[model samples]
Target: MTSTPDVIRGIVGVYHADGGLRGELAYLIGKARGTAHCGLCDVTHHALGRRREWRELVAALGVPVELVHLNERSPAVRAASEGRTPCVLAVTDAGHRPLLGPDELAEVDGDVARFATALRGAADRAGLRWAPDER
Candidate 1:
């Protein structure tokens, strides 16, 4: 295995739900019925909309963070995220790597602070370092 740290240039998050209006509606209904759950969603959003904590976390990360639904994910993301919904990917010059999986995300339980901590830990474990700010 490559032990050298990869310079993380960006981050990608894949939600468990599909994209588009119908998919969103279905996810909402399923969520209401307790049949569908996305830990990433819980961390990033609330009933009112995107959480302030999430925005702050993103800003502090000093990297581009892109969140996408199931249908919105690229083929590469789909492959890395296959069978693993609600996950986070680390983007590096080496390519994308799985940074956090569903179970890890679920552990955060809607807390942005916890998620940030988890992300930092995961990145370290994965031999990743955030890219230096261009500014």
Candidate 2:
């Protein structure tokens, strides 16, 4: 794993829900006892090539990025998802912002230029520096 930037002020983390055995169990539990959990991180488990794309894109901004497994029970992730998974969240000094969903990203159709523009906008909205050195 690449190291977190020394001047870190934010994280562009992606949270993915599970769609496997654990997911089924979580569903049943949530139905019964009202809780949840995830089996895997979708972006890491699938999207083989796009993982590199996501990494390269985040790397350029000089901020930490993480691919984390998310389930409905995780309050922060749940609040971030707001009903969906594979959500990109900008957790910054100012606050948290749910930037995109996997489906929204797919709409960009592998266009890094478009993705970067959106990311920069999110950074600005979250009061984070796209160029950490400038901060």
Task: State which candidate has the highest TM-score.
Answer: 1
Predict model 1's lDDT versus the native.
Answer: 0.92
The residue pairs in collision within model 1 are none
Candidate 1: tens digits of C-alpha lDDT, residues 14-104: 9999989999999999999999999999999999999999999999899999999999989988988999989999988777899889999
TM-scores, one per candidate = 0.95, 0.54
Query: How many times do residue backbones clash in model 1?
Result: 0
- Candidate 1's C-alpha runs over 4 A off are 1-5
Residue 20 of candidate 2: its Cα lDDT? 60
lDDT at 9 for candidate 2?
50
* Model 2 C-alpha lDDT per residue in residues 1-135, reported as the tens digit of each score: 333332235554444444468864665576357453222132323334345655576667666666555543346656766666655776654445676667655555546667667666755664555435432
lDDT of each: 0.92, 0.53
Model 1 TM: 0.95
